[model samples]
Target: MLPVKPFRQRTGYCGPASLKMVLDYFGIRKTEKELAVLSGATKKQGVQDGEGLVKAARSLGLKAALKDKATLADIRKYIKQEIPVIVNWFSVNEGHYSVVVDIDKENLYIKDPEWGYTRAMRLDTFMEVWFSIRGNVPSSKEDFNIRRLIAVEPHKPRRGRAKKK
Candidate 1:
């Protein structure tokens, strides 16, 4: 499992905060504010999609892809590769982004920015929350599937200080 630090989201900055945690795991250092600007996150709308996150990751020299219609198997696959994924879920009648850090046969470990901590969520809960954004899409183009995620390719650590465990 990655030692990804959680950031308490400032207002509607969950998207940027989640991205920051994933980037941190990949050895990419970026502030949440910077990520917010790069991801076009605003208090009014937050992050509408993962495209901006992909762009931000690419601009920071990491490969990132926005994927839809993802499943629990996909999340497990990425975790096995030691790459944290940024996933969108429905909570409190709105969409939010959280980082998937690890997984097991029955539980998925997630670092929730809003909660400011990492916790284990049951696979059943994962299925429900991960695929719960059916009719609450912000746009037609984003309506392909509510199971959206940002897959970022992990790279070697920078030749500086190693991340503390």
Candidate 2:
């Protein structure tokens, strides 16, 4: 499992808090206030979507991508690569952002910013929560689609050639 630090979200600062945890895991230090501005966070709305977090990561010299319709396998793949993924979860019309730190046979370990802790959710239960967005009902696992996924990674040098001294 990756060593990710959790920070409790301040009001609507879940997006920034989640991003801070992921960046901290990569050894990059950034304040939630800085991320809030880069992520377009507002006092009332916080962040509307993962795009803002993607932008914040990119602004920090990291590579970030925003994806929709993400799957459980996609999350697992990122976890296997030791990369933390930020996902938007919706519950009863309220949306929140959290980081996915590890995955096991039956549970997905999440670094939730709201609670500032690691929570284990069953694989099936995780999917069910994703489907809970907008009251969407999925007929099968294949039909599960997440609202947004922000994948961030530090920039890696090209492997084909070395830089001149």
Per-candidate TM-scores read 0.85, 0.83
TM-score of 1: 0.85
What local lDDT does model 2 show for residue 3? 77
lDDT of 2: 0.79
Residue-level lDDT tens digits of model 1 in 1-165: 667777788888888999888777666788999999998888867877778788878878777878788888888877777778899888897878899988888998889999999989998887887743434554665453478878877455343223665
- Number of clashing pairs per prediction, in order: 0, 0
Clashes of 2: 0
lDDT tens readout by residue for model 2, 24-70: 77777889899999999976778876778888889889999888878
Candidate 2: stretches off by over 4 Å: 131-147, 157-165
- Model 1 pairs in collision: none
Best by TM-score: 1
